[model samples]
Target: MSDSSDGIAGIPHPNPLRRLTLDQLRRRTSVKWREYPEDVLPLWVAEMDVTLAEPVVRAVTDALALGDTGYPHGTGYAEALSGFAHRRWGWDGLAVARTKAVPDVMTGIVELMRLLTGPGDAVVVNSPVYPPFYPFLGDLDRRVVEAPLGPEGRLDLDAIEDAFHRETAGGRRTALLLCNPQNPTGTVHTAEELTAVAALADRYGARVVADEIHAPLTAPDATFVPYLSVPGGENGFSLMSASKGWNLAGLKAALAIAGPAAAADLARLPGEVVDGPSHLCVIAHTTALREGVDWLDALLAGLDENRRLLTKLLAERLPAVRYRPSQATYLAWLDCRDLGLGDDPAAAFLERGRVALNGGLPFGTGGAGHVRLNLATSPEILTEAVDRMATG
Candidate 1:
C-alpha cells in the first residue's frame, strides 16, 4: 500500500475486473463476431467477444484526441496496477514499486524465458499448455521439457519434480512457466499443489514464472494461490493482464511482477526488456481497475453460466465428447478421443462443423485426441456449435 513515485497515492490501486452487457458488447467494433462474415463462431482466440467498459474506450479515445500518442512513462502507471493486484488477489505485500508495465503477457514471457535461461537450456512447462509456451522457449533455441498434466488436467507433481531433477542433474538451469487457471483445461492450481511446486523448484533452484493472466477470471468456488507465496519459494514472477478478463486485449496491456530475488537477476538484464508498452496499456488497465469491477463480476457469472450450459449440453447431447468441468477461464478442454475424429478433433470440428476452435495437439506432445472450445459466446451459438459437431 505504499507509493512508488511522487504524487502517487500510497494505497487504493484500481480494481480491473468488469463485464460488458450484451447490447454493449454487440455495439463494439472490435467484437470479432461483428466483423466476421463466415458465420463460423469465433471460439478460437482467447479474446472475449464483448465490448470494453466505456471508461476504457473513453480514456483511449481521449488520449488519441489529445494527439499525444507518445510512448508512456513507466512510473506514472504503477498506482492503478498495484491497486488492481491488491483488490483482485488480496495480495497484501504487493506495492506499486514491484509492478512493471508490459506490452503483452507473451512478450513478458519471452523476455523472462531469455532472462532466466540461456538458449539450448531447458524450460519446464506442463502440457497441454497454451500453445505459445512451446514457441516462446523453442524460438530462443531453448528446449521444452514437457511434463504432461494428469487426467482432469491436474498438474502431475511427480512428473514435474522428476523433470526438474533430471534437468538440474544434467547441469542445465531450468525454469518452470506455469499457467494458473491453466488455459484449455481452465484448471486453477490448489494451494497444496502450488506449495508442492514451490518446494520442488526451490530444491532445484529453478524459477517459477507463473502466468496468472487468467487468475482474475476464476470462478467463485476456486482459489488462486500465487506461486511465490509458498515456503521454499525462490525467485518467482507473475505475469497478468486486464486483456483476458475485460476483453481489452487489443489495447495491449499486461503486467509482470518479479519478487526481490528475481528482480536482482533482472537488474543485470537490459532495462528496455522491462519497459514494455507502458502507456496505452496503462490507460485501459487503470480504467479496468478503477471502474470495471461490476462488469467483471457480471462476466464471471455469465462465463460460469456458459460453463454449466456447455457441460450439461455436452453430457446430454454429445455423449461421446467428454468435457471435464473447469474452475477458471471460458475455454473447455475436451476428450474427443471417443469422437472418432482420429488424432485431431480441432481440425475435424472446423472442416466438418465450420467451428474454429483451437487444435489441442499443438498444446503439447500429449495433447493428441483432444480439442479446446472457447465457450465465451452466446448460448445460442454454443448450442449450434454442439449440434454441428454432434450431428455429424
Candidate 2:
C-alpha cells in the first residue's frame, strides 16, 4: 500500500494484490467474494483481488463523465492488443485487419467455433481444461473430444494427434479449442508444441481456436507463444483480453484475432456478433493494454511471490497436498489425492476448512483428485487458507 514510486513513468507500482485488506475485499460484490458465505475465504474464480490500474480507471471514468456510452467503433482494441503483444510476448503477428471485437473470451470462442464447424462436428480439447469448453461447445451441438494433458499437466502430442485423427474420420469437420497458458494448470504452451499442434490440425483439416485470455498473465520465467505466430498456424484463431490481466472481467471485452489464412473466415463473423462488446469496456481494455504496463508488471511480481509462497505453505503445513508452481495465470492446480480427501477435495475444503476453491470434476477427464486455487490474493490470506485446509 506504499505510495513510493517504482520508477515506471513516475507511477507508484506497489504489489496490487497486496494493496487491499481482507475487509476491503469482503466489501466487494464480485462473484469471487460473494459466491460463498461471509465466513468463507473465496479463492475459486478467475477474478483477481486487486485495484484497477490508474490509466484504466481514468479512461473508464472519463468516458462515463462524458456520457461516452455508445457502440464501439474503429480498431483501437486490436491496435492496443497488437502493441501489448509485441511488447510483452515479442509477437508482432497480430494483424489489425484480421481482428474483430468480441464480448469476451468464452463467447468469442463459441462464435469462432460456430464459424469453423457445424453441429455434430467434433471439437477436440485438452482435458482438465477450462470447464466452460465442455458446456459451451455442447450448447453448439458440437461433440466434445478429450485429449487429456500429460502426467506433468502439459499437452500430450500423442493424445492430441490421436484425437485429431479419430475426430476427422468420416470427413467430419473438427476444431481444436486450445488454451494457451492453460487455465487451472497454468502450463504455458511453447512455440514448438503449438507448431506441432498446428501440423496435426492441418493434417486432419481441423481449425484451431485458442482461448488466450490468460496470455498476459504468464510468469516472468515463461514465454507465451501466440498460436498464430507458429508455423502451420495461419488458420488458427486466438481470443485475448486485458480483462484477465487488469482485473476488468466485470467490464467484458476481448479481441478475436485470426491468422493470415483465416481472415476470410473471420470476416464472415455475424454483424450482430461484431457488435457485442461494450463500448465502455473497449475503452477500459484498450487503456489497460496501452498504458497499464507498469501496473501489470507489479501484479505479475506479486503473483509470482504468491506462487512461491503457496509452495512453501503447502510444503510446511500440508505436505501431503501437491502443488506445482504455475508458469502462468494466478490459478494453481493442486493434487489432493495424497491428502486422503475424496475425488472432490474442494467440497471438503469448503465445508471443513471454510475456504472455497474450484473443484476439478467439471473440467472433464484427468480432473478428479485435483482442485484449482486462485493465487491472486494477499500472502496472509493464502497462508491462512492453507492453515485451515491443514486442520480440515
Candidate 3:
C-alpha cells in the first residue's frame, strides 16, 4: 500500500492495521485475541486489529510520566470532539457546554435513558442491531420494543412510528435508541432519514438517544448525519468516542452530547456519573480527536480496501454467501443462509472452519443465518479467513 502524507513535517501515514504481524497480534491479551484458541482466526468482536496512533500513544505516555492519573477535569475532551466534528463532518453544533464526559457509550446511553424514562417505560430500537441493546435495556427494567430495519438494511420509519404509537398508548414514556451508521449492517443513516426520525419522535413524544460511536468510521463516499443536527432534534442526545475510529476501546472514554433543548436534562447528570471516565483515557481520546486525524484517514483507507477485497473474495470463493459493502464502519454483515448452516452460522464457522465470527441470532430479528465479519484487519488475514470458510 502507498503511504498518504499528513503534510505535517512531511511525515508519511501508513495503514495502521498493517503495522502489526500475526505473531504480534497473537501476543495481545485483549478479548479479541484470547477469546478463541490459537488455531481459530478470531474476527467476531468490534475490536480492530491495529496499533495505536502515535499522538495517542505520546499523550498517554506523557501523562503517565507526569503521574497525571487523577480524576478528569476541564472541557478538553468535549472541545476536541467539537473541533473534530467541525473539521470532518462540517458539524458546528457540538456545543462544549452541552457535553459531559462518560466512561463509555453504553454507560452514557443508560444514564441518558434514566433522565428520560422510568422503569417499565418503553425503549425502541431497530432490530438486527448491536446485540447489547436487548440485554442492557432489559436489565434496566425498560421494555425493549423492536422496530425491525427495512429489508434493505435501512431504517424502517413506518415500523418506528408503529412502535412508538403502540408503546406510548398507555401514557408510558418512550425513548428511541438509534444506532447511527448502524452496527453489523453498517448502513449510514441519511439526513432525510434522521430528520424524519426526529419528527416522528416529536409526534409520539419519544426522546432520541443516538449511539453515534461509529460516526467517524464512515467511508469517504458516505455522509454521516448526526441525529442532533437535524430538524426537531433539539431534544435529542448523542454519545460519541474516538475508540472505534482510533482503536482505543481499552482506554474507555466517551462524550455525551445533548441538543440545546435537552441541556437541562443533561445537567441533571450526577457528579459521580461524570467522574467515571479514566483521566488518562480522556487525555488519549482527546489527543486522538485533535491530532490523530491523519492516522484515522489511513485506517479508513485500509478498511475501505478490506471491504472491497472481502467482496471480491466472497464472490470468487464463498459465492453462496451474500455481502453488501458497508457504507461505514469496518464491519460486513454476511447472509450465510444459503451455505446450509443453521441460524447461527458462526458456530459452524468456528467448529468447522476454525474462523470465529459473531452469529446473527443474538442480534435479534432478521439476523438468522447471518454473520458479522470484522473487516478491520490485514488483507492477508481477511483473504485467508474467506478461503477457510469456503473450504469448510
Candidate 4:
C-alpha cells in the first residue's frame, strides 16, 4: 500500500450531519436471523451498526500484522488521549498527569472501589443508571446508598446530600459515582449540576468518580460538562473510553483520569490488578483519539439525526411511547409505561414485537416501565424497529 498519513482513507469533508442508512449498517454487521425473524429489530446493546473508521481499523490491523499481541507499552497512548481531551472538551494535559490505562469502564469502577473505599463503606449512586454499577459495587462487598433519581429523569441534589449526611453521621466512608450524560436517561448534567455534586462530595470528605464515556456524543442543543472541569472537580476522578462514542468497546481500552490526590491512590494500587486488552488496543485507542476526529464527528451527526427521526416517528406513530430528545450519545430513554407494558417493555418488545431493547429496571428503580434503545443504526432500521414495536 502507498504510504499515507496513517495508511487509512483520507479524511472526508467535515459534515457533522452525515450518516449512513440503517439498511447499510445492518448489511455491514451481517446480522443473522431466521427469515429476518418476522420483522425483528435488534437495538438491545450499545453496539453501532456502522463500519469501523478507517484510521482505527488501520491501526488495529497494523498492530496485528506486527505479530505480537503482548502487553502495551507506548508513551504516545496517553499523550493522544490528552490531546483528544484538550481538542474535544478543552480539558488539557489531564491525560498525561492523571490518566491511567485500564481494560474498560467496569474495571475502572471496580478499581475505584478498591482504591477509594473498603467493604461496608457507603457508595452513593443515583438510580436508573447503567446496570453494571449495581453488581460492580455489590461484588466489592460494599454498601450501596442509592439516591433515587426523580421522575423527571434528573439527579436530585437534595437526596444525594441527604445520603452523604446520613453516611457521615454514621461515620462511614462515602464516595459518589456519577454517570455523566447519564445512561438510560440521556440527561447530560450541566456545569452547575456537576459543581453542585462536587460541592457535596467535597463537603463530606467523600470522593467522586465521574464516568464520562458518553461525553463525546453530545448533541447540538446539549452541553457536556466534564466533571473534572467543574469547580471542586480537582478532588475527583474521571473515567472514560473511546468505546461508547466510537463503537470501540471491542478494543477494550479505557482510562481513569484523576486529581493529584486520587491519582496517588490509584498509583499505590498494585500493577497486577490491571488486566486489559493488548498492545493493539493501545494503537486503536490512540489512533481513534488522534486521527479519528472527523469520523467521530460524522458518527455523532448520524446519531443526532437518528435520535431526531426516532422522536418524530414515535410522536406521530407510536404516541403511547414517550421520549425526550437526547442531549448526548445515541441511546434513547423511552418511557413505555403508557403502553401498559408493566415495567418491562423490553421483554414485550422482544417477545411480542420481535424487537430487542434494554429494559429500564436494570438502570435503577425509576427505570421501571422504560426501555433504552441504541440508535447507532441506520435511520431505516430505527424506523422499522419502531414500526414493528408500535404494531405490537
TM-scores for candidates 1 onward, in order: 0.89, 0.97, 0.97, 0.91
**True-structure Cα RMSD, model 3:** 2.4
Across residues 1-392, which tens digit of lDDT does each residue of candidate 2 receive? Answer: 32212235555588998889999999999888888898999989999889889888888899999999988999998998998888887889999999999898888899999989998999999989999899889999999999999998889999999998888889989999999989889999998999999999999899999999999898999988999999999989999999899999899999899999999999998988889998999998988888888888899999999999999999999899888899999999999998788899999999999999999999898889999999999999999999988887
What's the residue-level lDDT of 163 in candidate 1? Answer: 92
Judged by lDDT relative to the true structure, which candidate is superior, 1 or 3? Answer: 3
Residue 138 in candidate 2 has what lDDT?
A: 95
Q: In angstroms, give how far residue 299 of model 2 lies from its true place.
A: 0.4
**lDDT computed for candidate 2:** 0.90
lDDT of each: 0.75, 0.90, 0.92, 0.79
- The parts of candidate 4 lying over 4 Å away from their true place are 1-39, 93-95
User: Higher-TM-score candidate among 1 and 2?
Assistant: 2
Question: How many backbone overlaps does candidate 4 show?
Answer: 3
Model 2 misplaced stretches (Cα beyond 4 Å): 1-12
Per-residue lDDT tens digits for candidate 1, residues 170-210, read 66789998989788788999878988898899889888898
Q: Count the backbone clashes (under 3 Å) in each candidate.
A: 10, 0, 0, 3
Q: Which candidate number maximizes lDDT?
A: 3
2 against 4, candidate with superior lDDT: 2
Candidate 1 stretches with Cα past 4 Å from truth are 1-37, 74-76
In candidate 3, position 306 carries an lDDT of 94
Q: Which stretches of candidate 3 lie over 4 Å from their true place?
A: 1-11
List the RMSD of every prediction in angstroms.
5.1, 2.5, 2.4, 3.5
